[model samples]
Target: MSDKLPQNRNNEEVDLLVLFDYFGKSINRVINFFYKIIKGIFSFFIYALKPFIRNFKLIASVVLVSAILGFIIQKTQRDVYTSQMLVKPYFDSKYQLVTNIKYYNALINEKDYAQLQEIFNISEEDTKQIISFDIHSGPENENDKIVQYDEFLKSIDSSRAKNISFKEFVENRSIYSGDVFQIEVFSHKKDIFRSLEEGLNTTFTNTYSVKKMQKRDSLISIERQNILSSIKQVDSLQKVYIDVMNDEANSNKGSYTTKDGMSFIQERTKTKEYELLKESMQLRQALSELDAQKVEEDVYFDTLSSFQDTGEKYTSIWRVYTLIFPLAAFVTLCFVFTGKNIIRFIVNYEA
Candidate 1:
């Protein structure tokens, strides 16, 4: 039994050694597999980069010439001095304003100075200096969902909106309400930009009001007139009540017993004056709000963000080219060189 035990122990040791050896070999295989993958990746990059490195002189020459041309062009370009008015225009769709800009631009490009002056009130010289009239908006792009501006919009809808149903209005509501928008103008001539800004603002202010807003404006006007008329009528009635009280007092507010024992002045005019005064006060209160409401025939813009001369202008033009040119040149070189190499290799293989 002892001898058999020794033999079994030796066999167990041999099995343990074999197991360890197998596990070690498995780990080595896994590590080698990953190493080869990484090595192959580095080798591929090295091979691909070698040809580009060999042609460094050519690539450098092309890049240098492109950079020099870009610099020359940038220098020759006139520095566009600009003025801007960041006004929030009143319009249903911002695109409407954008379309208007394009139309006005077309008018300018056509050299219709008379037409431009009539429409936008800008002079021929102003139109010539004006580079662009543009509109911009937030990231809530054309297709983006427009979340409600909150319950304020809903309440406004309930109060004034009529052309669209409340349900349709709520359903169709987008982030953009015409109450606020941006108007941007770009031009080289500072004087022209300044005058054109005011001209365009006035021109836009006279544009047609939306149907619902027009309806609301008419209603307000009617209501205001009605309130004023009622105030006049109520004042007259109040004066009559006061006159009756005065006459009664003049006759000696003294009560006398009749044969029927009913007092005439006291019974008739007792609460009448008080009631008339109370009602007149209420009508005046209602009429006060009507007077306070400033109604207009057309919707207009309020400049929420003011125009700063510096905010409108971009930084050094060279700075823009700094980031832009190198990347552009690199991409162009890669395309040309790679294509040239591919065509050359194919031609050689064919030969």
Candidate 2:
């Protein structure tokens, strides 16, 4: 048994040695295969870049010429500056405020100077070169009903737009409370920018916004009358009931009974009358509060943020060169080299 044990141990060692030697050979084969692939890739890149390297001087000449040309052209362009103002739209007329931008834009486009002057109180000179008047709004809470509807339509059609046509986008959506919106005025001159901003504020107040507020006032007045009428009718009905109860008690001469349809002292009838009176008073209070609000909120143009446009800096010569020089130079170099090579290719093929 001892002899057999020694022979078995020797066989196991030989098997282990054979396994390790096979693994080493397999690993060497994989390394050599990957090394050959890397060497081929490196050679391909070197050959592909040979043309660009050979024509380096000519490409450099092209880059210099193109960079200089770009610098000059960009320098000649006008620097347009934009002035922005922020305001919170009126709660009730928020939808109208956005819709009216389209109406205002039409006046600007038509060159109806007389009406524009009256609405905005701007001079003829101030209107010159007033590039555009625009309104921009940020993303509001998704929970807002108007925003939800807007999102839904945009999801379905992908083009829910506003202030672009006579049929305003707001006509389809709800209005939220005092949504903050931005007003931008673009112009070539800073003076015109300031003038346009002031005039826009005036136009919003006197023209579009005032008309909406007046309409709202008319609606509130109608509601007030309805509520008052309701209160008066309720009071009249209560008075008749009390009168009937009193007459029945008097006629019975202190012998009130359920059999005769009269309760002792008629407490339940008084309680019901009291409830009606309480409801009427509440309606009156609501009307009064609404009137007070109209007084305060009748006017428009609640400017939330007002800051003068920080004047734009004219493009410096070096700054302009820095922005355009490198990019123009690189693209021009690539194009010139590639184009030359393409022409050479066609000529060789013809030959």
Best by the TM-score measure: 1
What tens-digit string does per-residue lDDT give for candidate 1 at 141-165? 4233233334435666555644555
**lDDT against true structure, model 2:** 0.67
TM-score versus the correct structure, for each prediction = 0.65, 0.55
| Candidate 2: tens digits of C-alpha lDDT, residues 291-325 | 89888676675777773756353344554764567
Query: What is the lDDT of every predicted structure here?
Result: 0.64, 0.67
Off by over 4 Å in 1: 90-96, 108-114, 117-123, 138-148, 151-178, 202-214, 225-286, 295-299, 303-313, 316-323, 340-351
